[model samples]
Target: MEGPAGEKVPSDNQVKTFERTATGLVREISAFRTLVLDLMFTSPVFMFVFAILGIGIFVGADMVVSTLLALLIGFTTAGMYALLSIAYPRSGGDYIFISRILSPPLGFMVNFVFTIVNISVIGTEAVWVSTMALGPMFSGLGAIMNSSSLASYASVFSQPVYIFIIGAVVMLVFTSVMFFGTGPTFKIKSVLFFVAVFSVIVYIAAIGLTSTSAMISNFNHLSSTSYQQYSGIVTSNGLPEKFEVVPTL
Candidate 1:
């Protein structure tokens, strides 16, 4: 029946608000699952583990201390994730929790900090990936230009231009996916997950097949004077080998 304002109005008994709400919640959950799957594929776990291994190998005996530090960091990170997840299971992340538990001012500060950290990470990743790409490119260019005395020119190619370009492209693609909404993002996530899993399996297989004798030889070299000499050479090439500070006296 039409109301006085000529608008059709529902009878109290005609509306199923709770059913509609439940349906919407289910859809949201499905979408969230896709988002999480994508994130899992793109996660930094492999890089993190490789970084820890590198530090362990390079720092040698100091790995004991590094391992302890990594453990402490991991524990704290896990605790924070647990606390945030539990506090806002429905809302599902730190932003809402921050706003609710604290004043809006504090919440903004938290978000600001997070933005800075995220951008810093993006910048660092772009540089690192570009550097990795440059290694082979530089080597190839160096060989080609060997007779031309263009090793310096080859060195110029080592700059992270490719890295920044690739990073920008990735950022743009992801941003577009976000704008178009979660459907495509979810698909991308599934592919990423498969790739990540396959890569991990292959890495483990390779490591397992490596010769024990070769591993021992590598370990011995790491412990020898040559390793220290190489470390010093690498460090000094990048930065001053020693710092001189004038005495206050």
Candidate 2:
């Protein structure tokens, strides 16, 4: 019999060949696709600020060391997830594994907290992406065109009404896609995966090409003497830069 997502059931003798197996999920996703999804989950677009400015700009020459440490932690966490996924082979992730291995009550508590956090982060992240990523990107394009009026026009994305509307639309689109099924969701994610990889490469190349002297000069101007002021600047800029500093591109 065929399961959801077109996963076919193996015969009794066929199943005996493997040490362990699960029949619920479709085996449509390939290893490369899994790698891409894992990459997106771990090193998301939001992490660009940390990888670029946090390590390259602030930490300076120790960027490689910092990156290696982060990779070690990330891989260790990934390994655990892999093991759990193998053992459980279900959709619910931590909820399934915890509920099955530990206790249902404990698993419910854990997933409940996680669900709340995720719901909260959705709106916040949407607003952030609108104000920080899109707004600045358009504003920079306006600058290239030498139009202050265009820059001001683009800044509308930061407004409460605009942010709310755009965020709602994005959320609706995402929700619809997810409701459709795993196959469609996986297809969309695969496209995003390539884009993510390309963006990462570009970010790294940009940093690598920049002279250390220039970065140091920029850092000196951008650095704050106090933590409070520094945090304020970072929050205002959305990706952590001096409050007065403006992007030329």
Q: Rate the local accuracy (lDDT) of all candidates.
A: 0.59, 0.70
Q: Model 2 segments beyond 4 Å from truth?
A: 1-28, 51-67, 89-92, 212-249
TM-scores vs. true structure, each candidate: 0.56, 0.66
Alpha-carbon RMSD, each predicted model: 9.5, 9.2
Off by over 4 Å in 1: 1-42, 45-58, 61-76, 133-157, 215-249
Candidate 2 residue 13 C-alpha distance from true site, Å = 19
Per TM-score, the best of the predicted structures is: 2
Candidate 1 C-alpha error for residue 145, in Å: 20
Q: Write the per-residue lDDT of candidate 1 for residues 1-249, one digit (tens) a residue.
A: 789999877787894321122345443538556556645834645454555555534533343354466677778977886777665555554566677777767888888998999888767655654454445455555554553344444455466675567678767776687676666677677676777668777866867888877756564543444545665776766533432222100
TM-score of 2: 0.66
Which window of ten consecutive residues has the lowest lDDT sum in model 1?
Answer: 240-249
Per-residue lDDT of 42-139 in model 2, one digit per residue for the tens?
Answer: 65675665555654355223444565767778898778888877765545377777877788899999999999998998887778768877898878
